[model samples]
Target: MKCLLVSDSHGSETELSEVIERHRGEVDAVFHCGDSELSNDSSILEGVHTVQGNVDKPGEFPEDTAETVKGVRVYVTHGHLYNIKMTHIPLSYRAEETQARMACFGHSHHPTAFEDQGILFVNPGSVMQPRTRPEQTYAIASFDESGGAEIRFYERESAEEVTDLYASFPAGTQ
Candidate 1:
């Protein structure tokens, strides 16, 4: 299964729509890690599983959520509550508690893909404002039947893969 993960669009509805359209049939699900700044009625988030970021108003969105995709349990959050910029320990613990194989978040606007213990942690960066790199980015996580996963980061508008920012891990480890 393939899932598209994006974050921090901060109200660029056009770009968000484009990304969703571009991967419409290519991926099984679309996850927005938050800070979209768009209201719940916005069409841009029609089919996206999204969390609320610190910038978002409360009551309309959930702070975090969990889902199972292709037999992999995934935890999705905006990361401010976990102090993600300083450390992933808190988020990792939450993922483990939920029995999630992967965790997706955004807050620092930095793109990262790494494994801790047996769980995978991914931050697709900010589509509107990036900090770790110049290019605005998102991530595509693909899981195969053989119990393996590959995560690839891509430039949002151009849809070009950021080859150097990729990570892979075997399945059944988390």
Candidate 2:
């Protein structure tokens, strides 16, 4: 199954819409890791599963969410509550507790993709205000029932793959 992971768009509705449109038929699920700053009823978020970020209005969206897509358990959050800037330990623990195989989040505006234990943690970075990298980015993650997985980042503006930021995990039970 394939999923699109994006976060911290910070209210660039155009970019968010474009990114979602670009992968509309190519992915099975789409998740927005928060800070969208768009209204909950905005057409831009029509089909997106989003979480509430520190900057987003309280009760506008869920604090976190989980779902099983094509047999892959996914956990989505914005990360502020977990203090992600300091460590991923807290976030990882939450994902583990939920029995999720793929964990997606954003807050630091840094892109990262890696697998620890059996869960894959991905941060697609900030699509509007990037920090460590110049390019605003998002991610595409593919997983199979056999445990094989691959994560690739793409520049939000150009939709070009960020060749340097990619990860592939060996099949093992995810």
Candidate 3:
């Protein structure tokens, strides 16, 4: 299965719509890690799995969520409550408790993807306000039956793959 991971749009309807349109049929699922600053009923979020960010209004979106895709458990959050800017330890602990094979989050607006103790952690950066990187970014992750996964980061507007940001993990590692 293929999943599109994005976050921190901070209210760019055009960009979010463009991304959904671009990957609509190509991916099995779409995850919005939060800070969208859009309403829960926004058309742009029609089929997206989303969480709430610090800036988002409470009671509309969940603080965190989990989904099972192609037999892999994926945890999604906004990172504020977990204090992700200082460390991923808290989030990692949550992932472990949930038995999630991967965790996706945003808040630092830094595009990053890495594995620790078999679980993959990804931050797709801010699609509307990127930081710590020149280009705004998001990630596409593909998982196979054997449990192997590959993540490829891409420049948001251009939809260009950042080859150097690519990562691959063996089966069952996460």
Candidate 4:
């Protein structure tokens, strides 16, 4: 299945709607890593799974979530819960505890995609912050039952990419 990962869109429904409408048939699911500042209304999210971010007010999510997607054990979180900016050591430890194949998070407002410990770690960056790079970005990860993972980084609003980096892992590693 193909999933779109976005974050730190503090109420850009235009981009949200455009992305959903544009990727209508391309991806199976859209995951928003919060800081959305939007309510739980279906219209804004239309076809996405969203979690709360630091600025996302109250009652969005407790902390983290673990789920199985396309036969891959996936974990999603905002990363602020564990003070991740200073280091990934703690984050890696938490991921190990979850037994997840891929972990997704946002908070650094920087796009990253890589494999570590046989798992994929992705950060979709901030859709509204002053990023270190020129393009405000988001991520898309496609995975099959065979555990092959493909990652694409897209520039916000442009619908294109600043880079195209891909990687995959063997199945049953997590």
Q: By lDDT, who's the top model here?
A: 2
lDDT of 4 at 171: 61
Q: lDDT for every model?
A: 0.91, 0.93, 0.92, 0.76
Question: Across residues 1-174, which tens digit of lDDT does each residue of candidate 3 receive?
Answer: 899999999999999889888998999899999999999999999999999999998877999999998788999999999999999999999998989999999999998889998889999888889888888999998888888889999999899998888999988664
Cα lDDT tens digits for candidate 2, 20-96 = 99997999999999999988999988888999999998899999999999999999999999999999999999999
Candidate with more favorable, higher lDDT: 1 or 4: 1
> What shift in Å separates residue 135 of candidate 2 from its native position after superposition?
0.9
lDDT: the better of candidates 2 and 3: 2
Model 3 error, position 163 (Å): 1.3
- Candidate 2 Cα lDDT to native: 0.93
Q: What is the lDDT of residue 86 in candidate 3?
A: 95
Q: Estimate each model's TM-score.
A: 0.96, 0.97, 0.97, 0.87
* Order of candidate numbers by lDDT, starting with the best: 2, 3, 1, 4
Q: Roughly what TM-score does model 4 have, to 2 decimal places?
A: 0.87
For candidate 1, write residues 5-113 as lDDT tens digits: 9999998989989988899789989999999999988888888899999998786689999999878789999999999989999999999998888899999999989
Q: After superposition, how far is residue 58 of candidate 1 from its true place, in Å?
A: 1.6
Q: Cα RMSDs of all predictions?
A: 1.1, 1.1, 1.0, 2.2
